[model samples]
Target: MKEEHMAKDKPASGIPPGSWPVPLGLPLYVTVEQAAKLAGIGRDRMYEYVNSRADPIPQMRVGRAKTLIRTSAIPDYLRRRETA
Candidate 1:
């Protein structure tokens, strides 16, 4: 394929390379803020959901003050909710 004719494969996020902390393809893991952005919600809302018993966005408690969410969670949820 000609260089100019070929499409440049990029992550779906549309975020420039190196700007995002995790890979948009299949992130190994993500932080609260990252998860929030991926989930299309605000950071405070993400925290609220995480803290709620009926947690909509699940996260793993790391030690005392840290939390980590499976990077694929958002994508899987989105896939499930995608319109047929």
Candidate 2:
């Protein structure tokens, strides 16, 4: 079907297509690039944080292949920055 092909054509971001219900809600976590876009910062900066041990925004490593940032952590980190 056309819908099936459309899903296949979309790039993979580790998550398998249709593995979960769409329109359910946004993901709890996101790739570093998505985090960067959400925070209006560069991807490089996000990567730096991921590498740094003292980073306020915590990152998760999945099987040594993918790095993700918690969606809730982004704003929390920014607030911490403001207070500090």
Candidate 3:
């Protein structure tokens, strides 16, 4: 069933199955801390991105008190940093 879903380009469950997805592909979801670490930014900065009402934001809310950042958004986040 998992392989079938993978073949169809769908996640194993309609709901994402883990704290983070394997293979590091697009539409990836991760916790705030994880996302921040991946983005190479401070936790507060990550929150800023999550809370910002601006364009090119990189954060998402998974559940109440549970926020996720998309892996696809990482490049853009890094690009926002001049040195990155």
Candidate 4:
């Protein structure tokens, strides 16, 4: 049997050297301020939306102290506004 030699620098599946894995879920790291900017709303308005029972709500509370928003949700939020 021939021995298989794998390159040390390449990923196990042979994905190209410079390629990154596609993100599986939404990118969720924006601050409330950043989310507000992306939503084209004021920070206080974002707080209102977070407090309301609205669909397409982008903000999520992680643990007790950390709050985050998925970047992918911004477009949905904007579209919701347009249809409202």
Candidate 5:
């Protein structure tokens, strides 16, 4: 029974068994605050990351005040931050 036809199941893929595919069907853009929540970080911290010179999270300024981040950028940022 352990041997299967597929490569791996949901849990092995880091997805809960009954959970729906996420971020896959999510919007491409999200506000800075929303990005923070998605990344499990504080809004203030997200802004700090945005302002950091070392490795800032790339973001886009919509119009004058709205700041939006690309949905893929958050995970990409984390992947870059991964040391081990």
Candidate 6:
């Protein structure tokens, strides 16, 4: 399904699947795809980083339907990579 259409059917949380978790003015949490876009990475690579136990990026999941990554956490992950 197209990413935009992913949210056509609202989940139990009442929030759309692909929509941003935070309000318009605030940019705290974003969907993994959005995070990937911001970080200049592919969605698959972002998911791999999040799923990798060795150095997984922080994430929030809702019933396996929604997954969100903190925008702030991205920098921390990159910093760890730089140091290591």
Which structure is stronger by lDDT: 3 or 6?
6
Score each candidate by Cα lDDT.
0.70, 0.76, 0.68, 0.68, 0.80, 0.80
- The better candidate by lDDT, 1 or 4, is 1
- Give candidate 1 misplaced runs (Cα > 4 Å): 1-26, 76-84
Off by over 4 Å in 5: 1-22, 82-84
For candidate 3, list the clashing residue pairs, or say none.
none
Give candidate 4's whole-model lDDT. Answer: 0.68
How would you encode candidate 3's per-residue C-alpha lDDT over 45-67 as one tens digit per residue?
A: 87777777664466666667787
Instruction: List, residue by residue over 1-84, the lDDT tens digit for candidate 5.
Output: 564634365455665764543356677788999999999989998898888899988788899999888877899897887799
| Backbone N/Cα/C clashes per model | 0, 0, 0, 0, 0, 0
Which ten contiguous residues of candidate 4 have the minimum total lDDT? 18-27
- What is the per-residue lDDT of model 2 for residues 9-81, given as tens digits with 9 covering 90 to 100? 7745546666643234767789999999988989998787677777647778888699888876887776765
Query: How much is 59 displaced in model 5, in angstroms?
Result: 1.2
Q: Which candidate has the top score in TM-score?
A: 5
Error of 6 at 42 (Å): 1.2
What clash pairs does model 6 have? none
Pairs with steric clashes in candidate 4: none
Pairing residues by index, what is the TM-score of model 5? 0.64
Q: Which stretches of candidate 6 lie over 4 Å from their true place?
A: 1-26
lDDT of 1 by residue, 1-84 (tens): 764343376555566677664575857677989888988978997677667665355567888999888776666654654699
TM-scores of all candidate predictions against the true structure: 0.52, 0.61, 0.55, 0.56, 0.64, 0.62
Which pairs of residues have clashing backbones in candidate 2?
none
